[model samples]
Target: MHVLITGAAGFLGQRLVHALAACRELDGQPLSRLTLVDQVEAPAPEIAGVECVARAVDIAAPGALDASLDEHPQVIFHLAAVVSSAAEADLDLGTTVNFEATRALLEGCRARKLSSTRLIMASSVAVYGGDLPDVVEDMTALTPQSSYGTQKAMCELLITDYSRRGLVDGRVLRLPTIVIRPGRPNAAASSFASSILREPLNGEDAVCPVPTDLELFVMSPRRVTEALIHGAEVAGEAFGPSRALMLPGITVSVAEMLEALRETGGEAALARVRHEPDPRIEAIVASWPARFINARARELGFQGDANLRDIVESYLGERD
Candidate 1:
């Protein structure tokens, strides 16, 4: 099987690439060719039976993905995006990268008649917002409060329509905020979700921009990677008509996260964190639902982290 992954240079992209390299196959088919696409050149992994190709291309540019689509990869992992806060900050950039590029990619697939190709897109929990229920469900109305969420929702609909029309086989995994990401914080409003744990464990000071009681729906890097792989392997008919699945995740507040930090990294690590509220970050995060009833995901065999402690420990183990 030939597979192509966009945003192959990002943290999640890098993790997925490593996981695929370790497995050396997808859906029982031997992974023969792997194409990595990113704004920057992604490093090609040396898998035993796999041919890896890394390309630095602006996917939003006209005809940017034409050559890659011409290659006719059997599966495409669309992980590239502008992210939440960054997207919210720049409307044009967000629309171009997040929504427009995705539409173009789908159009390319349609034009080539790649009906059998599976396109697994990475969406976000931000799609649910404004007067949310105690637990967001698969069938919940998408009332996004952020530009990022709006863009993702739009893409989700487009993918669904394309799938329904038999133009493409697509699956959208609506992910929660991924916590304990390794590396310095980015522009994401939820960056503090990782920063609070990652920085403290690294012996560096970190800021908590939201209140301790503020809750967040989060998944660990390990679990999200597994979900991405599973999404690709699962049969397309498994998705039914919607073609979108909200992945399971644990609900934890900022205080709970700190407690987990204290457990794994000791009191000193906990002391490295300071609470300093930022209204912008808080508002953005507050708009996202912190609890979800992901029955669809569970039925589909997608799993989440057991707890925040396990998530913190997983990051520490990798750091060590």
Candidate 2:
């Protein structure tokens, strides 16, 4: 079967490509072809019996998606988005890339009669708002606080509706803040949490944006990828009203994160990080939900949410 993966050059995208290349269907069939699309182009990996096409194109460009999916992929993983800071910085680009691009892709799949196509989408926990009731039940509603969050919330609704109508088989994984992400930091507000610990481990002083007590939910890059792929290949009947899965993650305060880092990396590593909060970042983080009830995902036979210490150790191993 052929597969299509967007955000193919991104951190999660590249990692997913490597993982997918090694995966075999339950029936023991290997993936026939893969179409990797991204805004940035890279030298494609050579894999035996796999047609690897690396293309640089704005999927947001009108009519581009229709031309790309002529083969009608059996599976699609949509990971393209403007992310938190960019979405916050430019609302127009945010709505266009995050919300409109999603609709267009889903619509493209529909127009192509890809009824059996299993489309796995990457969403975020930001969709849930802050200041929830004292005890957040599994039944609490999603009330997004940021434009990025709002867009994610809106897309979840669209994904579920598409599944219900049988136009497509949809699985939306609402991912949490992925810690120990590899690569240089960019505009994402949460970059500090990982960067501070990561850079210091490399013997460089890293900046901490939020205070030590700031609480947030997090998972490692490994878990995010595993959960995402599981969502894509999972077997199930036509989904209920909600086709989304709130993936498992751990809730820890900034202090707890640093303590875990120190324990994993030693006092010298902790000493390399400097505590300093950027107001813009702190304010944005303050409004995000710290924890969630992802019982639905757990019941579906998916699991992650390993402790912070284990995540830190894995990240350090990758570094050395």
Candidate 3:
């Protein structure tokens, strides 16, 4: 299988690429070549069976899709996006990257005239917002409040339409706020979810942008990457009606997260987190729903972290 992955330099994208390289096969088919695309040059994966090529290209730029489409990839993972807070701050940039670029990529795939192609999109829980049920189900309507959520919701519809027309075999995975992320914090409102745990474990002080009572739906990077690969393996008939599937994730409050941190890294690590709420970030996160039933995901064989401790432990195991 010839595969293409956009936003290949980002945290999750980078992890997914490495996982694919390590596995060397997807759905029992040998991975022949992988084309990694991003604004910055993606790091090449050294795997024996697969030829990995990293290209620096902004898909939002004109004619970029045309150039990327030359690969004629049988499977495409659209993982690139301007993150939450960044998108909320700059609507134009968000639209360009999240919506326009996504539309352009799907159209480019349509132009390929292939018999069948699998297009997997990395969407988010941000797609659900404003007075949601205690546990959001697969049938829950997408009521996005932020500019970032609006862009993702719009693209989900576009991908669904294209798939219905037989243009591409599209599958959208509505991912949760990935916790215990490595590296420094980014502009995402949910960055604090990882920062509170990651920084504390690393012996650095971290700030909590929301109240201790604030709840969040979260998954680990390892589990989400596995879910991505599982999405590729599932047959189109499995999706049935809609192309979008909300992946299963665990829900925990900030206080619970701190407790988990205490267990993993001790009270010294727990003390490293200081609460100093940022209203702007608080509002953005507040608009998101923190609970989900995700029955569709469970039925589809996607899984999430068992608990907050497992999430923290998993990151520590991977990083340390």
Candidate 4:
């Protein structure tokens, strides 16, 4: 089976590539080819019996997706995006990259008319907002506040409509804010979630842009990758009426997360975190739904981490 991944240079995308390389198969078929596309060249991992190609091309550029989709991959994981803060900061760049690029990729898949193709997209909980219930459910409405969320929500609708028409077999995983993400921080407002943990643990000072009590629905990097891969293999009929569903995640406050970090790394590590609030990030994160009753995702076999402690430890082990 051929697999194509966009944003292959990103944290989640890179992890997914390595995870797939380790599995050496997809849907019980021997993994044959993988085409990794990003604006910057992605690191091509050497996997036995897999033809790995890394292309540093702007997928949003005209006809750029052609080379990436040329293989007619059976499984496509679309992980690219402009992110929350960056999207809010630059509307034109966000619209071009998030919406236009996504549409182009979907159209590419539709043109192939490949019924067996699995188009698994990475969506965000930013898609939910405005007078939300105590806990978001499968039936909850999408009222996105940020431009990033709006773009993702729009893409989700497109995925649903396109799938209903059998133009492409699509699945949308509305991922929660993945915490303890490895690497340096990016423009995502939620980047603070990982930064507060990663930088301090690495013996550097980090800022907490939100209040101590600000809540977040989070999953670990490991679980996110697993869920994405699982989402790819699920039968379309199992999705019932909608092809999109929120993935399960644990809700924890900033204070609780810091406590877990303290336990794992001691008072000195906890001391590294200094609260200097950024109202922009605070508002963006506050508008996101932080508690979800993802019975649908649970029934579909997606899992969350044990707890914040486990998530912290997992990050340490993975990085070590």
Task: State residue 50's C-alpha deviation in candidate 1, in Å.
Answer: 1.2
Candidate 2, residues 1-320: lDDT per residue as tens digits?
78888888888888788877767341245777888888977345667888888878897788667766788988888998888778878999999889998898889889988877888889987887766764344577888887888888788889888878888888888887889888777678888878977888778888898888888778888888888778876764523468876778888888888898788778998998887768989987777777667677787766776788888888988778
**Taking the candidates one at a time, how many backbone clashes does each contain?**
0, 0, 0, 0
By summed lDDT, the worst window of 10 consecutive residues in model 4 runs over 108-117
- Candidate 3 per-residue lDDT over residues 1-320, each given as its tens digit: 98889999988889989899888898899999999999999998888878888899888897786766877888889999998777988999999999999998888888787437888999988888887887789888889888988999999998888888999989999998888888998877788999999999999999998999999989999999999999989986688788898888898999999999999889899999998989988887877788888877888889899998889889989986
Q: What's the lDDT for candidate 1? A: 0.92
**CA lDDT, every prediction?**
0.92, 0.80, 0.88, 0.90
Backbone clashes in model 4, listed as residue pairs? none
lDDT of 1 at 135: 81
Clashes of 1: 0
Q: Against the true structure, candidate 2 has what lDDT?
A: 0.80
Query: Ten consecutive residues with minimal summed lDDT in candidate 1?
Result: 180-189
Q: Against the true structure, whose lDDT is highest?
A: 1
Per-residue lDDT of candidate 4, residues 83-121 (tens digit)? 777888899999999999989888988887766689999
Top candidate on TM-score is 1
Pairs with backbone N, CA or C atoms under 3 Å apart (clashes), candidate 3: none
Give Cα distance to truth, residue 134, candidate 4, Å: 1.8
Q: Estimate each model's TM-score.
A: 0.97, 0.94, 0.96, 0.95
